[model samples]
Target: MGGVAQSFGPFSVRRLMDGVFEAPVADLRHLGGSGPLAAFTAGVAGSTLPMDVNCFLLRSAEGLTLVDAGCGSAWGARYGHARAAMKEAGIDPGDIDRVLITHLHGDHALGLIESESAYFPRAEIVIPARDFAFFTDEAQRAAVPAARRGGFDVAARVRRAYGDRIRLVGEGAVTEGIVLLPLPGHTPGQAGYRLGSGENALVIIGDALHLAEAQAADPDLGFIYDVDPVIAGDTRRRLLGEAAEQGWALAGGHLPGILRARATEGRFVLTAV
Candidate 1:
């Protein structure tokens, strides 16, 4: 499905597509547990699976809020349409009052800046404090194994764009109805943004569950980039459980289609609404 918009409580959320990319099956083997990787890719014809990159545009009486910036042109042609998608939804980058970053992952934050300029000129970029400190620390980044060094570079570039406009926040409401639901382990301070109250609420699970088919069916499945798979799995279970019990809607950063979901039989069942 194409990028769609939905409403809940006082917020209007529009799903903005950032294009798609293929992920190698070998890389996700660790998340499969005893379920063979072949089972995960059974229907797929290729050696890699396509993952959708999505960001959210939320509007309320208070202001416009973007859940995650998305992968810009920097990531190449496979995933760099966030800005265009936003415009298609009748929202502009400069009009975004707040940019709530789920994490500093290259795809989630690269769109925050373009050529070292703030993409959302007037927006206050709200970021998790733990992530801000970790990704921006040159020494700490260098300490990360060489394979993961590129993450630090992307974070540094995004940091340079926000400058003073960046606001570091801990667990709690970053704005009017938007609450930060901590979902660490994916990143040092990765989180999902909770909007609204009671049954009408929606939680944007940014990178908390990358492969929806595998992770949603089995929360224990770990992504390759999870900083702590065990903790991440626990967080996923708890959050999904709460969502199931409370009847709260869900949106994932890499979900295929129809962001709305509910946990049934310990698995997330997607809904068109």
Candidate 2:
């Protein structure tokens, strides 16, 4: 409906498509803080404190799938427009069958709730095993710096709410035609997903690239939430290089646009087409 739905690839089976699940930027700014706000404002003129929180719904034969759930109801008070966006995309939360969580960050997983329960009741939540452990472990929670403690709490609540629906996966193909590429460092189990085959492939990179300017131009620019900056930078460089060389469409969890890929300048760039 409208311009929210777009398609790629020459055929249905091989086609990679995405729908925008728009949420408010205010919620994102509040959660991400001033640093993210400053970065967004500087990169995109007129950008204010909160940049819109947009999630993606990917279509495949297996059924409707979601990339990251935007900040759910808890944070909805400030940024609840995501639900309306989903409606605009014609996706009923109950209809989503699978949710691939890129990491345990609050902004990404917080939206998995509905009335104090898992929002996607029948959906199987896919997460990295390493990240699952990291957020669920009490010892690890205590180890996080005071500033990051809130994130740990949010992640824990998600785990408790989803419980059995959570399915931990690793670096490899978890489903036919879909591959989970491990891109750790942003979190213990941060990951990216590759869909389709040959030249028709698309990769959904979650939180691996926060700001297009810093990530696309300088993969080395690390974010405050990156658990391992060095490793995260390396992963970004490697993924960016591979996507560019192979001519695969790339999508970032936080980046604007539905699909983006690096141009062939041997430098990181984003192609909205």
Candidate 3:
């Protein structure tokens, strides 16, 4: 799969992971109503559905900041050739100055590792405080069902290796231009980032909206892995409304390209440009 690069105002965005499979549209009806199902079927076609799972690298005057790391070596069996895509983009793991993890999901955080060590040794790994607390707690891990326990394990290993370098940011400015907005419910402390100076801004909605068509058309739908479906749905609805009203550029963790169009009310169409 080929990666794409796009410019959103002052920030430069690039797709680090291009292809991944997701469930069919019919399966999405369980999430909410028929709107999402119809949008998914129409926008995404063909069997063996290959959707893009992107990691964005933002370059600013201060330094290079990565949004989410794609599937690491552990998930190679499923995603294949983890680091090759980033390498192709000319992003050296060592050159990354900061890594902002949207959540602790394996696919998003796993690629932080390189040669059995944390991938960005010189970079500070920023995570939401609530998510860090939940994922690192031993009791929480034991309480989760077996099927979801693997995620906790991955979180544990990341915490152990990068304890000192891990920085926690709540709903505020992590850096000068990057503001972390709490978008919770996808995971306990999942967040979206708003970049740029003022009214002209782009919201890096990390996993807050997974599939562009499904989410844009029906913001109430939830993905299967969503930790709190109700909250996720509500957040999605509110964010979509706000983004459309504000005319903000929206980017997502699993969206197909480096940048995707925000749907206008009633039209249900995407303008990628």
Poorest lDDT segment (10 consecutive residues) of candidate 2: 10-19
lDDT (Cα, tens digit) per residue for candidate 3, span 78-174: 5634367667767677888998988888778887875557877788998888888888888988887676766687787787778799898899898
Q: After superposition, how far is residue 177 of candidate 3 from its true place, in Å?
A: 1.0
Please report the candidate that would top TM-score against the real structure: 1
Every model's TM-score = 0.90, 0.80, 0.85
Best by lDDT: 1
Q: Please give the CA lDDT of all the candidate structures.
A: 0.78, 0.68, 0.72
Weakest 10 consecutive residues of candidate 1 by summed lDDT: 29-38
* Model 3: lowest-lDDT 10 consecutive positions: 260-269
Screening candidate 1 with a backbone cut-off below 3 angstroms (N, C-alpha, C), the clashing residue pairs are: none
Candidate 3 Cα lDDT to native: 0.72
Off by over 4 Å in 3: 1-4, 24-49, 77-82, 197-199, 258-269
Q: lDDT (0-100) at residue 110 of candidate 1?
A: 87
Candidate 3, residue 73: the lDDT equals 71
What does candidate 1's lDDT look like per residue over 1-273, in tens digits?
235567878988888788876777666644446565556557567677778888888878988888888877778877778787777667677788988989888888888878878878899989998888888788887777777666677777776877788899999978887889888888878888888877798888888877765676777766577777777888877887787778778887887654455767647765555
TM-score of 2: 0.80
Tell me the deviation in Å of residue 145 in model 2.
0.6
